[model samples]
Target: MKTLKFKPLVLALSVGMYTVVETSTNASPIVGAELRIVLSEQYRSMIEEDVEEDVEEDVEDDVEDDVEDDVEDDVEDDVEDDIPMDTQDNLVDAFEDQIIMSLDELLEDSDGESTYSDDWLVLADDEQLNALEQQGYSIISTEALKGLGSNLVKLKAPSSFNISKDNPSLALIDSIADVNHVYQLAGRFEPPNGTSFHYNQLLPALSSQQLRLGMIDTSISLEHETLSGANIKLHNVAKEQYSQVKDHGTAVASIMIGQKDGFTGLLPTAQLWSASVFFEHKQQAKITTAEYLVKAIDWMIAENVDVVNMSLAGPPNAVLEQTVQKACDNNLIIVAAAGNQGPNSKPLYPAAYECVLAVTATDQKHKVYRRAARGDHIDIAAFGVNLLHANAT
Candidate 1:
């Protein structure tokens, strides 16, 4: 009798019950701290209004209809004719007073409410940043995300600034002219997970074919038995740490390109580009931020992979959304897990992005996984319960 040695099968797990607890009690603005600001369209609207006023004043009431027709004609001829340079300059000159009045009115209405936080993601432009700096906010950093063309500027408030008494940033919104949107950028995505199963039957290997596949997950073990012979590339984007676990990424990579120990992946010869984005958080939960995910996507885009797999889920982020949209526009296919947020949980992204193909899980019985998130965004279902995978030694 021949004895066959079987390696232990490990499951790719998900973050089941990890929650971030807010540590700050006081809503004080931290000077020299970074905050992202989105440029608003309101400033452009105000400029358009000034242009309209100028037109109305120059034209007589009797010929107003004729003049309006000519203006519309001019708009059709050249869109830029709507808000010329002189009108824009006038708006910029008046912006300070407008923002001051707006902020004062908001403060008056608040009646000493504390709705501001020390950390914020603001939507503003260079001109707006100047106005904000004049009002005591400090510019920390600025990044113009490629392809999306959105300029995100990080700013800091004065050291003594306390929004608990007054929220000046709210008023600064008016002067910044192009402030688009503001959001608090503290959220995390759950890690991928699965169950382990053993199969005694060995499947025959299919003919190998070349494929370009990308995966964004944890680190992968390069010496794993199943992945040793596969063409796999790694890009480390997470923080370096000791005792790092590569089981999850290794299993995922195996499922995509492994062909060892009698188990074969869908594309055994596919070239894998793996991006490590998850890291240890508090020694328990695996956490990844939106910034890291965006950077991974950017890397994948640069590599021009055919299809990218995101076996993780998190809240919607503007930067991530723009990056995904740009990827789709470039004809890259994005395959994402629909998430393990439970049946009643809200939809997750980039799975929710229109350009992505959101995949959910099911068992051999064709029943949906209990923890699988369900929604109209889910594009397909796959067998994900108790699947066998190569164990990292």
Candidate 2:
């Protein structure tokens, strides 16, 4: 299997990486520390060309060997000052070993690697609730998951614990990972509310050409020029923050319903019920949680959207799978991104789920996109390259 391996620690004398993010293949994420920063040969060539004068003394010592002695001062110094931005590893390595980085900062990057958290979610009930008390675990959060004709508790574990097969970074080997609720459905299952989603009578009658679709992505810009006067209703499903949205949703919404001269969306007259689940992270791009996704899907179901678009890629979750199946049982059609992790990467969900149509990216020439994930689940292809579309900004 193709695995991402970590290098040895740089080992500064005074400080060390207080937290570590370990990279493993098909196992839960582990925290690691003291990332090593290798001084490539280019360090010498660059200094030889750019050095006008040293701060106090010449950088005459070999970049690697002699500098090892003064690593505390030379290496411990904010790394960006000594090294060029283009050459450094990812954001994690550009710091002193002693620095206690926040989870967001440490996870800000990997080496051309999209960063991920090792956090895992477990299904528990009041009797099985292994939810760590705020006093013990690193962090804890809970959500109500409606699945399999019963209510289950979704518990979020800290980075130290993780589970699931799709996100190889997590493992269910921990003791807590085993203390999950195991229930068997007794009688023939009926389903949620014992009914399928039907169009709302309150909604205006639609023409034959009009369709009902749902957008489960970032927030949409209803006022964007392309989307003006379009039948798009946005529901912010974030639990806390009331006003948090981004541009990705706007771009996607434009592609679905926006109609202007020389440009037209696939369903220009479609009635879109958009559920904005993503919120602006403290530092990262807009981020959403599995809970948000479940809530969004539930909202879409209530809205009676015939089809929904999930433009996201990530590890699979049991609750999410259950909710998706529920949606499928309601006769809702789910479409998802085929993922950009390359052909060799593992399948991402909900695209990988049997209930969804995994939509892969192609170009005007019908060639598969260079990074579009290839898998048996990919049921369709769409134009993914080089076209003028609406921008949020």
Candidate 3:
């Protein structure tokens, strides 16, 4: 077997390439910029059209029933009563699909790998999935169908890599490689020349752990002195649409695990899991789609991770909620941002889930972030407002 190395987010299952999609958003002031209206419109059309089709189908069914019952005292006149019920069911169905699709689209992309031709792929085992996800690969939509008259599972495009057949040694490499270990990244610890109090407080603990960090935003620098002591892992889950320059993940990681010299993170012992899952540099994509997130969480659980931090949010999602719940049940401390879409205080997933620890950011002024989501879902608050960290500097 030829020696080949696997990237952080895209695993090398075979001599192939992959096209991944992920969620992306802008920084504090640019949050709205990340919400691509056109993308949303396409998605909304896809959804509304589906609902309309369902309503028409339901109406026809109602018509048939009414005709059958007409002899029993004008049952046709009672269709109004069923209208409301039909509408409610349709609405619920639409909402569910929207949630699912939003997550899927955010995690997938229109771009594919240069060497391979497949448009999609999925990891089968928990171990493989986690290896991909922590580096920021989330599933959008996938088909795992039972074969004709057989119990065997057949995955759709980008079938799970056949490590044994395609590149068996790659699998062996992952099993033996320590890249998954945080300490391996070389430039992760050194902070920028001009550091802040936050970085000063956090850097040492991370260095002592020998762990590296990965950030998915543009604010942090891969060459910064502080991060120099650590490794700088980057990913473009959104393809060329995004800059691969933003450092939202970097800033957030710095807050949670950034080294000293100036800024400090919550858990200094943890290393960075740097990945950029966005496109067009400023569009909203699901950084870690629900499917990939499940795998990522599982990986963290298996590794017995000390903490998993997420500084992003979106509407409530069932699969995501369940995954976080399972992670917590397994004793992994999951942390998430309270979402910058707040002030109106709608609920956000992971952060709002019962098992997660939701944190809201506060600025230097000690005031809550204007967009930080609020409501009963918010469990705790952190100094997120205009806060400086090693990644930001």
Candidate 4:
């Protein structure tokens, strides 16, 4: 008999059990001590070269598109032939690890053990939950429980339904808003500097193409003024890590979707599919677990999403690699933030994998982010410093 070895899986609490608390408390985000964004002449020269290359590539594509259009006019067009042209591939490495290091420096004096606290109120079917509870799993709260059918539950710690070593039951909730009564924390970031993105640049393009983006991040504010009128989809993979929403993920999402007449994202018409792998409290130090990220990949695969934009990184893990590979196999475009750790090519899991697209940060002037990672693995670069995002509402 042959034995197959499986990697150990970490179980996260999915259900929230709130204990009659009056108000809410969330952990503060970690901020860096100094805000530094400088690109040397050598780096500037590199950016110029890259920009030239990009222009050349665009010209080539335009010529190819013209030729293909002429061909299609004569014969039926094959969609598969056009697919690769629009697909996002060959991105450069954009690491702003300096930002993370600065954040850690700012929190140097603070204790790293603090946890974010928030609430997730879920309205569920009572009979179904009761059936689940009867199976030795405790029932936390039910939504719309008043009409004898639906109930609401306020959750605090992470809870689960059916989790085991052999079979892990992955739950797919329809929409983020459906999981009502969730208090999210906000992360403060110094928007990347250099080119100020405007809606005109990205929104009109996306709207014309009817495209949406899946932002797998920590949190988002549905009521934020900048995020007004944009289609957003939220999912809480962190389950109990609602507090982190305020400080981190919300800021990232805002950068991607925040509505400023003058400021826009790379994909403004892009609707966000928000998911969190780390809690707000965990930002004081590096996150040790990769399960939440893995689950996010699994969710994307299941949903057959167009693009998965994640701005988080950590030490590489085999499970993380496998999940990224699977996502690639599913034809999902996975874009990840290069580790902020600067010039270290040791390899950062999903970003390091051939299946994923590694994006490094550049300045508004298109200068390379000082701490951006580099190597043969790097594919493309983008602005990550002094950029603008949604303010706390």
lDDT per model vs. reference: 0.54, 0.50, 0.39, 0.43
**Candidate 4 residue-wise lDDT, 240-328, digit = tens:** 42244443555565555555554554445666677655554334532323445656666666665666776665454443555566567
Across 1-393, the per-residue lDDT of candidate 3 in tens digits comes to 111121211110000000011111122210001111223345545655665555556566556655434433333235435568668455554665566444533321122101111112332344544454453433444333111111111122223322223233324324211100000010112222222234223222333444333232333455554455554444333344224434444445444454544343444554555444432312232233333344455555555454555544544433345556666666556655556655796666556677666666544355665555567766554443223543333
lDDT of 1 by residue, 209-234 (tens): 46577888778888877788989989
> What stretches of model 4 exceed 4 Å from their correct place?
1-205, 282-288
| lDDT per residue (tens digit) for residues 1-393 in model 2 | 111111010010000000011111121100121122222344443443333234224544645544644643554355558766656533322332223223343231122212222233443443334434422443345555443232333333433332332233222211123112111100011112212111111111223347787878777777677788799888888754334664556656655666665455555677888888776555444566666677788777777877787777666556577778888888777777767667797887777888776767654466876667787887665555443345564
Which has the better TM-score: candidate 1, or candidate 2?
1
- True-structure RMSD, every candidate: 19.8, 18.4, 18.2, 28.4
Considering every candidate listed, which one attains the maximal lDDT? 1
- After superposition, which runs of candidate 3 have C-alpha atoms over 4 Å from their true positions? 1-221, 231-245, 260-269, 281-288, 364-366, 390-393
Better of 1 and 4 by lDDT: 1
Kindly state the number of residue pairs that clash in model 2: 14
Output the TM-score of candidate 1.
0.55
Assess the local accuracy of residue 318 in candidate 4 as a C-alpha lDDT between 0 and 100.
40
Pairing residues by index, what is the TM-score of model 4?
0.49
Name the 10 consecutive residues with the lowest summed lDDT in model 4: 9-18
| Clashes within 3 Å, all models in order | 22, 14, 68, 53
Q: Arrange candidates by lDDT, descending.
A: 1, 2, 4, 3
Order the candidate numbers by TM-score, best to worst: 1, 2, 4, 3
